[model samples]
Target: MKDPNKAKTERMMVKRTLKNLELNRMAACYVETKEDALKLVRQIIPDGVKTASGGSQTLVQCGIIDFLKEHTKYFDRYDKTLSPEGRKQNEREAYFADFYLTSANALTEHGEIYQVDGASNRISALAYGPDKVIIVAGINKIVPNLRAAVERVKRHAAPANAIRLASGRFCENTGVCISPCFDENDLMCHADCGDDTICCNTLIMKKQRIKDRITVIIVGEELGY
Candidate 1:
């Protein structure tokens, strides 16, 4: 069974995070399960709308990818039949999609979305492009502050994602960033992963000019790396 006290504490944290996210001019909500998350996503995105997503395990875990494929005009960049050029074309087209879906590397309780990327297409689209952006992340992705958010990505997200993508990056073999140690001065947290580093681009989303254009769904269950 789950610990009731821990669950209560998490609920409080999610509440605070949601408040801050709204204060930052972004929409935020919490769901108790992945099923609820999927349902909320469906409600936010109507059927047959043009949709695309960043490469996110969270979306897969929540069945959002399959839902998009079945219900929306989804641009599948991962389609096996697509040649390199075709995949590139699909990725470019995703910028103009009606809805863009992604998961954050880290979401701060102070209401910031932090993401690290390789090709940077994901961050680019999240920053601007899609008419609406939906971020589905688990409570495990939340942190106390920006500093902790950065640490979470370096210590956990980067290494795990490297293994997933089989990018042959240093973090994949090391199970952590090349330099995991960080002080206040090391907020940028640069790692020496060489030329093929997946952490090439980093994005920190704070206050948004476009209110509610980005909606964040924070699942109570741990869903992704």
Candidate 2:
């Protein structure tokens, strides 16, 4: 395997690049395991705060969901234990939460966060509503730049997510993003994927108009799609 130190150093460079763009930032942190990430997450999130989360394999992998549910007043719509109506109520409450936690589809070295959503609740919270947004990204999610960021989502993140969500798209079966050539203005596919598209909404977190609003955590371990 590649040296773990080298991997973390790369993520740090991306974190620094993000800070240079003047988005609120904390120094990139490297933890050895998922348990360590969970500890870090628990420490960062204050007790009794109203928190909510977007769907993230990373969150589950790092043991954040259980921790948040137990400690913080977290609105989790993904809980299978909740009734359908209850889940919808949770999702609606999440929009007004004090903190919103999520993982990035791709975080570019040039300081941009690229994400795709089916229903867009997550992206909407990231763009504007929440009092605080914490984006937890594993080193693997870092890309070279914006183009690579988009490519990362389409080629890797989206396909995995489609299968996980049981979206019944071509990519779910073929495990490919099925890119089609479109104009400069259009980044989404108009190809065979049609109505079953998972790339329904795209959000690019660029220069932050509000300082200290979004904080990104760069975890050393590989954690998500």
Instruction: In model 2, state the lDDT of residue 186.
Output: 54
Report how far residue 142 has shifted in candidate 2, in Å.
0.3
Model 2: per-residue Cα lDDT over 1-225, one tens digit each: 668898677756755755653542423344656787788888888889999999999988888988889999999888789998898788778889988989999877777788888878789888877888878888788777777777777778888988888858877877767773333555766456668687888898877777668877777668799
Q: Number of clashes in every candidate structure?
A: 0, 0
Model 2 lDDT, residue 128, Cα: 74
lDDT of every model, 2 decimals:
0.90, 0.78
lDDT of 1 by residue, 1-225 (tens): 679999889889999999999999999998989999999999989999999999999999999999999999999987999999998888999999999999999999999999988888899999988979999999999999887887898899989998998969888898988778556655543645678777888899999999999999999999898
| TM-score against truth, every candidate | 0.96, 0.87
162 Cα displacement, candidate 1 (Å): 0.6
Which residue ranges in model 2 land beyond 4 Å of their true spot? 4-12, 21-32, 81-84, 180-186
